[model samples]
Target: MTSYLIKSILCSGILIVVYHLFLEREKMLWFNRFYLLSALVFSLVVPLISFEIKPENVLKPVITAVPQIMEEMQKTGVINSMIATAESNSPPDTMQLLLFVFDGICLLLLIRFLVNVSSVLRLKSRCRNVKIASAKLILVPENIVTYTFLNNIFIPEKTFENAQVRDEILAHELAHARQMHSLDVIFIELIHVFLWVNPFLFWYKKAIRLNHEFLADEAVLKEYTNVKSYQLLLLDTVLQGRQMALTSSFNYSITKKRLAMMTKIKNLNRQYIKQGAIAVLAFVLTLTFSEKIYAQIEFKSKEVAATFPEISIVRFEAVADKPAKKPDQKGKSGPGISKAEIDEFYKTIERNTTYVKNKKGRTDPMVRMEPKMEDRMYELFSQMDTDQLQMAADSGIMVFQMPIPVKKAPTPEMFENWKKPEIFGIWINEKHVPNSELNKYKYSDIAEYSLSKLYGGALKGRIYKYQLDILTNEEFDRTYDRRANDRVIITRVGWVGENRPKSFAGRRI
Candidate 1:
């Protein structure tokens, strides 16, 4: 809101300067009036008009390890250091207090404006009205100066005794009345009530008043051939015209400019050039203003990422240690396996063994064995058919066959239950996902997967490993794993994809 006001003031100032340079002495009163009024309206409205144009392509930046430091700081609740510093250094509610002060000033100015308007209305009620030609002259009983409000011209009763002076003053005030210059005065006065703090508004009011005088002087001179005679009359009645806030008076201390305009010759060529320049200037300002408005209104995706940096999973691995075994107590033979028990255990293993098809579609041995142990294990399963071997593979492992079946590929879900290392951590797009959620996804649903080591800040020399799995459409198919220490996943749904480009120059590290 404050920025909008500042832009409005700047635009208005530029327009006023243009007017003074080009149209002020052009002799086109109505055009000048419309231009000034339009300038005011344009300045107020231009800041609100915004146009957003989407580029055909948007480039994405590489998420470097540097931003990982910000992610770590955020996790530790220390990323708001700048905000903490600002709060500690600055006064609380300072901006709010300033706004309150500004509002108070505007209110006071509005009251003053209303009071001045009411004073004019009161004066009009007390005056006596008499119609002369087309103007309704209001004769005030007090020994005060002359001024015109709307269609009524107010003058002192004592001034009526001098017929010649009265005629000149009436002619000047009548011009103001016929042209409806009081409306302009009231319009500026109302604007002043709200924008009283703007110094330009004060000067703008003076410019408006001076222009009104120029217009009235032009109207009066159209009838009277003697410009010099009119100048003398202006000099004489200048002291007789009282300045009023909401009315156009015969004189408002702009006598010299008015007299000078009367004698000044119009230059058509110079006027045309200036008008062209002003038009071009206005066009350029409008384009610039619209761009500013668009910048304020439009939201950038990159900025959102900057505000909340993403935390990618860099690596994932299973825990290496197995459960500890109980210590055996000293006895005659502590819990020695009996020959019958060994036979039963071997029988149990043989019953459970099965052979399953591997990735090659071959029904290999259900369990892997050393080259030397392979023949011995095969001898036990020599009579077994491919189907029987496959069934044995499906069942699990046998000791005499082999200790365990060929290792089945792990699914996304299996990784969830797999014992994770105590120091291992995982994150998906800056959010922590529990093992429960991680287990729900299938491996093939992942469009891209890799392992990487993040390095920066305290992690500069040290490497923190993680796994990055970017899903295609959150669905499942087959399972496969390929390992890369440092990799990028460009998937359609997550990571760098269609909307996010490969590289962006404007990205902040």
Candidate 2:
């Protein structure tokens, strides 16, 4: 919603600047009126339109690698201890509070609009009517400026005595009545009730009112013979102009512009050139506004791949073993299993297992496990390395793969103690869950998990912390089939970090 408001405001501002630059001084009164109205409608609608450019299927290979590793981890029981935790800093009720404030402001403006319309109706009812040519002349008791609302031309009761001034006022107001300029004023007032926050709308209203005056002035000059006398009559009535939004007054604020427009020569030959330029400008503005609309949509595949950079797995290392305690002379037991027993168990597993070596001579443990014997394989490994296994349980170590060498590594001090992983939160479909509810599900139920940073107003400078996104099997299979090279992106989370398969930047995940 906020993004849409911003886009609307920006689009309105650009259109208004274009009007002031090219169309303001042109004698095309109807063109200017339509242009300003079109701008208003465009501002309200353009933000809702969305356009997207589909990227080519060039990234399929890079994205398949992460899912393969995830599959291997599930089979090997590596992700059994995975845990996640996240902290929300934004107040839960802030969005509601903002909406309430906005609605209240709009309500007040709506009431003001109603009041202005009612006041005009009240004035019309109280005035005395007298017919003059094709217009209904309304003689008011108060000393107010002459103006037109609908077919009624209002004038001060005293103006009836001065025939010349009365005729001039009547002619000017008759032009307003004939042109139906009051409809434009009423339309803009209604628009103001809702979009009062946009200052460009206010400028647009002013431009509209000014163009109405130009149209009326042109109409009055075509009928009235004495030009100099009419000019003097305008100067005389300037001070008596009333500040009313609902009515088109004879003497509007822009008296100087009116006088200049009257004498300005019409250039009919240049009309086509100016019209062509306006058409070109409109096309350019449409493209500009369309770009803003398209910016709001999330990209499908290529964008996801760009977010998760390729991270090479180096090797796996067993955490350092603790020293074993000796038995007491009294034949009492010590705190832990003896070192000789642990060594013997480790030797038995090593003799039975086979490890595959890659081109870099790094060993992959998953390659040795048989398909149906996973449970028995896990039982053998668990019994052989009970101490390290217990440490993995308490520390929440999912898979302990070393990361490829990079420019910067976590400080050695970060690894001095067996640092337990800090569970932040679980994310499914980009929504955070503050508890371990996901642990009830089997690893096969989950397709894959991506480590990325969560972003929001609440999470502002804490972008380095990792968010674990768990994808359901269905979502994973569909994405993998449609765009296998595309990464499974968790919306509202930023790109994955450079350091992979380790504590995020030395801080526990």
Candidate 3:
């Protein structure tokens, strides 16, 4: 999920960079319009496409080695995976809380979108409709600028009184209605509702809005030959209007680009050159963001088999690989684990502790297994010959881990000590701050924390013995600010093999 978001953002960024560098300056308004919409839609789509390459094409040097010792450990029963332990209570999952926050914000934006649409609908139903020359104008009571929504051109009662400006404004808005620019606004707004955090969407919106103004200006100039008068009128117009996300406003502060594009001469050669460059960029981005899969290949060498038989077995097994599921936390009952038996085993070890001299030259308790445990251990190894036993001893003692019930994830309540006044210095997300900084956050916002004793450190001329560090859930942090990080990170990580889920967003996009 993280990878998909990153790839989509990166692809959008690359396309945006090319547009700004090569296409924006050229006199190719039509091509620019097509490219802007196509690039945005392509950015959203290219990350979901992938190409598979057969393993025969992949280099063998870097991919041949496989870890086979893990398989041996599994066969020897040394990797006990079924050990069960008692379950304990835990804090609220931060990820779930972040998800809830995201959905809540999306709902609010959706409602706001609907409200804007309804307000337009209400105006369409109640306002006086006056048809002038080929345009439908909705005369509203408010002192706002002329704007277009769907098929209706909304005109302010104050702005409509002027005879000369009215014709020009209506002509501009008619172009918008004819070109269906409102649909573009609606589509981008819907995207903004969900992916508002994506900075590229904001850029895309600006580009889309600016392009609409250019198109409208081109249409108005075709009818009215006075480009200077139109530019002056645009400059003279005030930017006081009710900003609607779904409507294209006539008084947008994009007069400079609109005026420049009106006088600029169209060069066919330059347009073709820019289009070819954009095509190359699109192709490069497709390959860069795409997921590449390779077919399974088994390399067998007689020399490698004579040197390491285990690695050869692993290579063969790699030809038919499947996804490995993570071990379940709430394990079922299995061998070598029972509450009563574990308690008895610990009691035996405690009884057999003996005093011995340590490296510090002080006598400390050394724990040893009781004779009964020693007899059981010997019985397990009785079948091995002397050579096998010597080899085992040379490999050193192996400790088999048993699952113990404990709190693994940090809880918000655990930071209560640091929250107390003047008790410990607080640091949230690696920034030093006062203890009061924690007041705004809840348990579900924190991902993890650490406490450490400060030996001889003073902060703000006050001596502190301990300090607390906190790392909040990133999803929670991102909700507060959408433009926090401007840098885009592109990664080539993806899932492979037949076990990959069939109903994933990346696969469907």
Q: Which stretches of candidate 3 lie over 4 Å from their true place?
A: 55-92, 132-135, 158-165, 298-509
- Candidate 3 residues 229-286, lDDT tens each? 8888787764765766688875546767777888899889878877887788788888
Q: Write the per-residue lDDT of candidate 2 for residues 78-151, one digit (tens) a residue.
A: 43333212224435489689888888989998898888878877887887888877778787777787778888
Number of backbone collisions per candidate: 14, 8, 0
Which candidate's lDDT is highest?
Answer: 3
- Compared to the true structure, candidate 1 yields what TM-score? 0.54
Better of 1 and 3 by lDDT: 3
What are the per-residue Cα lDDT tens digits for candidate 1 across 1-509? 56577778888888888788768878666667777777877887887665544322211222322224333443464424433554566565897798889889889988988898889888878877888777777777776677888888877766775553445567778888888888887887778777765567776777788888887888788877688998888877766535677877645367878888888887778867876886788788787665321111111111111111233422211201111122121221222344454344334333433333333333322222233333433344344444433333333322122122112233443333222422223433333343345556564433432222223221221122222223233221222221121111111111222232322222211
Q: Among all windows of ten consecutive residues in candidate 1, which has the lowest summed lDDT?
A: 485-494
Candidate 1: deviation at residue 327, Å? Answer: 48
lDDT pick, better of 1 and 2: 2
